[model samples]
Target: MCDQYRKSYRLGRRPGEQGPRPLSRNQDRVEKLATGTATTTTTKTKPTTDSSTANATTTNSSTANPSITILTTNPTTANSRKTNSTTVNPATVKAKDSSTTTKTITDPGRAKTRKPNQTTTNLTTANSATANSATTNSTTTNSVIVKTRDSVTTNTTGTSTRPARITNKSTITITKVPKCKTQKLKITKNTLTVGTWNVRTLWAAGKLDLLRHEMNRYRYDIIGISEVRWTGKREIPRGDFIWSGENSNHIRGVGILLSTKAKKSLMSYNPINSRIIMARFNATPFNVTIIHAYAPTSDSSEDDIETFYNCVEEAIEKVPKKDVIIITGDWNAKVGTDNTGWESVMGRYGYGSRNERGERLLEFAAEHNLFICNTRFQQTSNRKWTWESPDGIHKNMIDLVIVQKRWKTSVTNCRTFQGADISSDHSLVLCNIKLKLKNKPRHNQRYDVSQLKDQTTRQSYQARIEDNLKNIHSTCNLNEHAAQIEKAVKEALQATVTLEKTSKKSWIFDQTLDLTDKKRKAKQIKHLSADSIKEYKNLCNKVKNRHDRTKKSGYKINVKKLKKDYKLATAEKRTVW
Candidate 1:
C-alpha cells in the first residue's frame, strides 16, 4: 500500500542515523508508546501540543535488519498544518476480528521491535463505521505515530464534537440455606463429683464457701446435696438447677441437683414418702437421674427397701434404651435387705445379715446394669462417705450416686470440693462434664494452621482470639450451665421437631418394649441377698432352738402356701395381704 504524509512535524527528535545533528529541545514528557500505531486525542479541558508547529512531511523508512523496517522523519523541518486546539468526537470502540494475529508496539520509535507476545487490537473509531477498526498494540516499548489522513482532515476545519462520558459500574448480593450433617454425636465422657453432707443449712455451713469457691474454680454441671435443708417453700438457689427426692410422706428434707446445662434431658420425678425426690435429666447423649433420697431411719424394713429399688427401676424403664441413666441417694440402712432375698446397700448399720437392706440396694443396682460412681473416682470407699458423726465414729456415706450401663463415659472429673467444714457438716463437690456438643467449631471461619509456621504468627492469632474473648465478658452468673446447655440441646431437638412438622413419618409413635418399670417395684415385698440368706437361716435355727416357746413358723408357711393355692384355684381376686 502506498503511504503519504500530508502536513506533519516531529516536536521531539529521533536518533541520528549518520545525520547532521539531532535536536532534543521538544522533549518535556514522552507520550504513550504504541506499536506502529497512534490516535489523535486530547483531553476536553487540556491541550497537549501547539497546532502551528506542524512541520514538512518527510518519510524515509529503511530496514537494516531482515525482520523489521524503520520509518524516518526529519525533525528540523516545518510545514503548514496548524490544528492542536481542535476537539474530536468520541465513541465506544468494538473489536473487528478474533482470528488473525497482529503485531503490537508500546512506543512508536521502537515500533519495528515487535514483541512475540503482543496482541494488536483493532477498535472502531467514530470516523470509521466498521466494527473495531482502530488498532493498538499492547507491547510496552517505544512507539511511532503513523499520522493518518484523518489527522490532516481535522486540521482543515474545527468541526469535531465532544465524546461520550465513560461511566463505571458494580453490584453485591447475599443468600442463606439450611443444611444437614451426616454423623451423629456420641457421649465420649461422663464424670460426677458429688457430695452429700448434713450441712445444717446451705448458708450456715462455712463449707458452702469452700464448696462454692471450688465449684467456681472447677466446672461442675451436676451435684447432689443431701440435707440441703430446703424448705420447698424457698426457690432453688440456682436457676439452672432442678431438685428431686427428699423426706417423703414427710416435709422437705434432702434432694439432688441436676445440671440443666451439663445433662442430657430430665424426664420425671418420684417424690415418695413425700420427702425422697428423684428427677432424671439428659446430658450429652445420655439420660441421668439425680436422687435426693432420705430413707427414714424409723422404717428400715425389707419391704421399704425393696420399694426404693422398684421405684428406681421404674424410672429407668421410662428412659430410652439407647440413653444411659444414673441415680444418687442416701439409704438409711447399712447392709440391709427386703422381704424377697437380696442384698441392697453397702455398710453395716448395727444390722446383722438376718436383714440385709444395704446389700439388697447394691444387688438391685448390679442386676439392673448400674455402677457406683464413687468406685471410679475415690481411692478409698471411706473417703467418699458423707456426714460424719460429731464423734467422727459414725462416718459413712449412705449418700451415693450410681450410673446405669455404659453411662460411665458421660461422667468426668468427679471429686468432693468439701464435705465436713461447711455449716451443715456436708462438704461441697465439684467436677467437669463433656457434653456431646453440636458443631463445636465455627461453621463460617476457615482454619489454616499452615500459616502459623513461626511463633510470631501463632502468637498474633492467639492474641486476636484472647482479645475477642475478653471483649465478650459474660454477665451470666452461676454458669447458667444447665439452662444454656438445655438451649443448645433444645435447638437440636427443635430442629428435629420441625422435621416432624414437615413430614408425615415418625419412628417414636410405634416403638414398644416389654419392660414394665412400675411392676418391677414392690415396696411391700422384702428382697434378699447373701447376708439376708444367712440371717434367714439363723432365724430358722433360732426358731428351732425355741420351738417349745415359739408358734410353728414352718406351719405358718404351710398355711400361707395353702391360702395362695386356694385363691388361684377359685380364680378369686386376691391381694397378697
Candidate 2:
C-alpha cells in the first residue's frame, strides 16, 4: 500500500485520487509529441487535469461554468523542452445558438523529431454561449499544434459574441498566366520560261512570222534572238519584237520577243548596240533583267571581241544588283566538256572542245560570277549542240543561257531544241526558270472611234455627254471638275461606242506555212543526203519568194485603201465647207 502511494505521487496523482492514473509520468517530457492533441474532461464540483498531460494546470471554476485549455509545441528545435500553453476562461468565452466550431491541424514530418526540416500547421475553433446559458454548458475543446524553427502559422474560426486574438506570422504566394502566339501566311510561287534562239535574220521576208509561230508553239515567255540583221533599233508591237542592230545597213543584231504576258510585265528596254539589247520585267521576289547579245564570230579580231564584251559589261553594270540577270544569246564560243578550271562558271556536261573564244567566255563568266546554264545539264550530243557547220560535219555548243551564280538554282533546265527551225543553222536554246511575274494591267481599251464618223452616232454621243454633264455639278476643286468632265466623256463613249473587236488574220498563206513545216522536217532528218540538202534549199527559196510577193501585194492593197479614205475625207470637208 505504501509503495503504491509513492508511485501515484510521482506520477502526478494525489494519494486520495479515486480515478484511474496516467499510464506514464515522464511522457510529457518527450522530445517530440503527437500534434493536434484534443482533451475533454468533466468534473462534478472541482477542477481536474486531463489524463493526456501530466503538467497541465487548471484553475477552480463552478459546476455550471466549464473551461477549455489548449497546448502546443514547436518541433523545429530538435532538443527543445519548452511547451506553449493557452488557457481559456469560462467567463470570457461566449457562443451563439446553433453555431458550429470546426478545428483542423496538419503536420507533415518524419517520425524522428531530430530532422532539421519539418513543416507544421495548427487551427483552432471554439464556440460557446453567454453566462446565462452556463447551466447547459456544452464545450468542445479542440487543440491543433504545428511547430517549425522561425515559421509559424495558425488559423482559428469560431462563432462567439467576443472576438478571439491570434499572434503568428504567415506567408502567401501568387502565380501568373501566359499569352498566345500568332501565325504566318504562306506564299505562292510561279514558273517563268525563258528561251534563247539564234534567228539568223529577221530582215528576211516572212522570218518574223516563222519566229512568232515557233514562239507560240513553244509557249516561251521571253525568247532572246541573235544575229537579227534588222537595221536600226525598233520595237514591233505585232510580235512584241524589240530589236537592235546597225543604224546604216543589215548586220549582226540582237532582239527579244515577248509574249503578251511578258509584254505586260515589261518595265523598260534598252538597245545598247547592235550586239546587245536589254529588257527588264517587274517580277515577284526580284525584278528580271534580260540582256540579249549577239557576239562576233570566233575568228573576229581581239579588239572586236573586247569591245563586244565591254559593251555587255556596261549593260550588266546598269542593271540593279538585286535583279535577276539572265544573259541569253549566241556567244559563238564553245566551252567544252572539261570544267576543271572553270567548274564554277561551266559544267562538265558541255559538248565539243573549248576554243580560244570559249576561254574568253569562261574568263568573263568567272569574273562576273555567272553560271553557264546550258553546260549545267546532261544531254545527248544532238540536244547539246546549238549550231552546226554548213557541211553538217562539225557542230558546237556556242549559244548559252547565262545567269548569276547566286541564282543558279532558279534555272531548272537548259538545253537545245533541234526541231525549232527559223531558217537558221543554229538550234533554239531554251531555259526553264522559276519566277513569279507581276500582273500587268491592260490600259489600252480600243473603242470603235470609226463610229464617230456617222452623223447620227455623233449626235447620240453628244446628247449622252450633255445628259451626263447636266447631272455632274461643277465642284470648287479644279481637279474634281476635270475628273467629272472625264467621267462624263467616258460614260458617253461607253453608251454610244463599242469596243473594237480585233479579228486575228493570218497573213501567210497555208502553202507558205506548209513549205516552212516541210523545211523544218527536212532539217530534222538525221541523215541528210545531197538530194535532201538541195530540196531544203529549194524549199527555202520558194518560201522567201512567196513571202516577197505576198508582202508587195499587201502593201499595194494598203496604199489603195489609204487613197480611198483620203478622197472620202476631202469630199466630206468640201461638203461641210
Candidate 3:
C-alpha cells in the first residue's frame, strides 16, 4: 500500500499534470466499505513538488512506532524530500511543514485531533446513528465545539444517538412519639443538722445564753427544746426561739431554736398549746416541718395523753404531703431494746424495756411510718439514754427524734450529746442528715478509727505506720512537728484502713441481765414455801388491783374535768363573740 501511494504521488507531480485530485465521494465510500472500518478520510489540494522530492515519499517503516509524517514541497527545495519521522502520541498531532501535512490515523473509535490550522471542533464517530454526534465549526483554540441533534444520547459503547430517560422512586414516613417517662426535679438542697433536747425546764436565769453558747459551738441548724417553760406563744427576741405554752402556766412548754441559717429558711410557726409546737422551714428536694412536743408524764391521765397525741396528729396533718416531717421531743416513753413487732418504727438499740407510754408512742410512729432515729443507731448505754433519774441510777431513752421512714437513710447518726448542758436533766439528742445543696460549704470528712481494732487491720496498720514513720525526721518547730505527725497518721490510715461509720455500741449490760435474773429467781423461790408464795401472790394481786383502781378513778376524773373545762371555755368564747 505504501509503494502504490508513493507511485501515484510521483506520477501526479509530472511537469504539466494536474496536482493530485481529491477522491470522489463515491470512491471514498467504497474505500471505507472495503476496509470494513469506521475511518474518516479527508482530502485537500496542494501545489505539486519537484519529481525528486515527489519520489522521495518517506514511509514510517516501523508501524509499531507510527507517528505523523509531515512533508513540505518547498518551491526552492522541491527536489529533496528525505526527512526525519516525527512521532506524536494520540491527542496531540502537529503539522511541522506548513506547505503540505500528513497525519497517520490509528483508531477513529471516539474522537479525532483538531486540525492545527483550523478551529477545534467535536469529532463524532457514530455506529448506526445510535451513538452521540456533534457538528460545530466555530471552535476556539482551547475550546471544544460540539453541536448535537435534538435526540442525541450517549450509549455505553458511544456508537448511537438515542436519548435515555431516568426515573426515581423513594418513600419516607414519620409519626409523633411521646416520652416514656417525665421526671420531676429538685433544684437545690442543704445538709440540715437537727437536734432535740428535753432541757427539763428553761426557767433558770441566763439559761438562754447557755443554750445559745452550746448551739453556736455545735452549729446546729435547728433544735427542739422541751419544757421551755415560757408563759405564752411568742418568739423570743434575739434568740429565734419559737415557743408554745399554756394560757397561764410556766410548765410543759415546748420550743424550737433556729440558727441564723435556719431562721432564714423558716416559713411559718404554729403553737398548738403549752406542750406542742410546730415549725416549717424551706428546703430543697422538699420543705421540712419540725414538730416539738413535750408529752405528759406516764402518770398523767389518759385524757391528757389522748389530748396531746390528738394535737400532734392534727399538727402533722396540716403539713403538705410533699414536705419532710420530723417529730422530736421528750415523749417520756421507754421504747426498750426489743424490736420484735415494732421493727418499722423502733430499733433494737433502744435503752431500757418498753413501757406503756412507749407503746403509745411506738404505735403513733408506726401509724405514720415514722422511724425513731435514736433507736436505729447502736450506741453505748451512756449515750443512748437522754434522761436520768435524780438518784443518778435510772437512765432511759425517753427523748427521741423521728422522721419519715422514706428518708431514714438521711439520718447518718442519732444519739444524745451528753456534753451539752443548759441546766437540763435531759441530754441533747442530735441527728445528722445529708442534703444535696447548691453552693453549700461541705463539711470536713471524718473517718472512724475503730476498725483498727481488728487483728488483721491492726497488723496492716502497724506495718503502714512503720513505713511512714521511717520517712520522718526529728523537728523542733511546733507546726512542723504537728504536721509530720499528722501526715504519718493520715498516710498510714489511708493505706491500711477502710472507712466505717461511727455508730454507737449496744446498750445491753451484764449487770442488767444479772438483776433481771435475780428477779426471776425470786419469783420461783417464792413458790417454794406455802406461806411465802401466798404472801407474794397476795401482795402482787393487791398492788395490781390498787393500780387498776387508781387508773380507772383518774380516767373518770379526767373525763369530767375535761368536759367541764370545755363547757367553760366554749361559754366564754360565745360570750366574747
**What lDDT does candidate 1 reach at residue 171?**
8
lDDT of all predictions, in order shown?
0.37, 0.67, 0.60
Residue runs of model 3 more than 4 Å from their true location after superposition: 1-189, 436-577
- The C-alpha stretches of model 1 lying farther than 4 A from their native spots are 1-214, 231-238, 244-252, 258-260, 263-273, 333-355, 376-382, 409-420, 426-577
Model 2: residues with Cα > 4 Å off, grouped in runs = 1-189, 442-446, 451-504, 570-577
Worst 10 residues of 1 by lDDT: 168-177
Q: Which 10-residue window in model 3 sums to the lowest lDDT?
A: 166-175
lDDT per residue for candidate 1 within 263-287, as digits (tens), equals 3343455554334555555444544
Better of 1 and 3 by lDDT: 3
lDDT of 3 by residue, 273-336 (tens): 8888898877877888899888898789999999989999999899999989988888988889
**Per-residue alpha-carbon lDDT of candidate 2 for residues 1-577, written as tens digits (9 for 90 to 100):** 2221122223555533454455342222111122121122212222234332223333232222223322222233313332232223322211121121212121112112211111221222222232221111112232233322222223222111211322221110101111224333333348788888887788877788878877776857899988888888888745378988998888888899888788879888999889999999989789999998888986789999999999999999999979999999988898899999888998889999988999999999999999999888888888899988888989998889999999898777888899898788889888888887786565667789899999999999999999999987665588888899888998899899999866556567787888888888887663468888888888888889999988787788889988888899898885422
Error of 3 at 446 (Å): 41
- Which candidate has the top score in lDDT? 2
Model 3 scores what on Cα lDDT? 0.60
